[model samples]
Target: MKNLFLCSSFFDVAGILPNFLERINSNCIQTVSFIDIASHVEEYKEYVEKAKLAFEQQSLKLEVIDFNQSSDDIVQQLQKNDLIYISGGNTFYLLQMLNEKKLTNVIVDLINYGKPYIGESAGSVLLSENIEYIKKMDNPQNAPNLKNYKSLNIIDFYPVPHFENQPFKNLVEQVISEYGESLPLIAFDNKQALWVLDKTIILKDET
Candidate 1:
């Protein structure tokens, strides 16, 4: 019952957002909480800035939440916000933090119980059926204690973001071939996204 905006990349929002987010009204969006994972890795931190800027450009206010915060604090933020935007990062590390902090269930319950959520890259991967499709992109060793690879299963199909072109496209093919037998996979470019409202699902591309 939760509506979701699963983005491929927040950096190119200026090009993809108009047509992709046509169904959503910016005014209706009250508050947004940015669930950040990029900070865990020094390189992915820029993604957080891009994400925050993307939302601000659309007049959306946000609160940033990272692993340093407690589950209770995260839950409080989730309860106060109208939307949750989980940014891209090391998927393995992100999942590790989620488990280590015991916040996985809190997030799953919130989103399933009807909290609007947004994800880019690793964030998108976390909500899928399992992180198996991204084995090539993330290091499993980063999350050694992870017992299950199962994802939130918020969406029936698996979506691989950042499949812009060439080598990335080829990687997508490999992922699809590996998991396509049991799970339907959707590929999205940096300028594309998957929008879910109510029970309907659709793909959104740059204008």
Candidate 2:
């Protein structure tokens, strides 16, 4: 069964994370594989620090993994962790690194095997079958080496993170207005999340 918690912003929904973990009977999670390769800029680095603190508050030891610098074994690193967290950043860059490192299949297999996976923003979008839908919201120029917009394909519906939220509000609306009829978009705000448990899916609101 696939256990996925897709969120617009991890900090926005961090308080309710424990409840979700409880619902999935994963309260015992101790170690997490924090994938923050998407956050390459100085500004995003600050957000990553807060994300690390969030995990620390839950008493979850995090093994931060950066595909850009680390030469470690991806499969072994992920397999050793109790949970997998993909932070928010440039969607194109994130996909480019994952594709370059060939970690997409590894992550998909682990999640399918029941490993709890948490995705924030870009992370959430990467689970969709194709990431081309988010081109308007995220700059594709960040990933010049990307061969295609294909993604993990773990979920059938396209996730529109930060829906109706600032900065991305207009962009999100544009994406919906253009792809609403052509794509299966599951749009949600920062305080909401898309929970996927096996074949059952639910849109959870923290408001």
All models, RMSD in angstroms: 2.4, 1.5
Residues 2-71 of candidate 2 have per-residue lDDT tens digits of: 9999998887778888888998999889999999989884255666788899899988899988565543
Candidate 1 has its poorest 10 consecutive residues by lDDT at 18-27
lDDT of each: 0.75, 0.89
Q: Candidates' TM-scores?
A: 0.87, 0.95
Clashes of each: 0, 0
TM-score of predicted model 2? Answer: 0.95
Model 1, 1-207: lDDT tens per residue? 766878778776545554444555533666888878645764547768877887888777888876677788878888888778888877777887888778777888888877777888888888877886788766777777788787677777777877756546776777767877877777888887788776788787766
Residue pairs whose backbone atoms clash in candidate 2? none
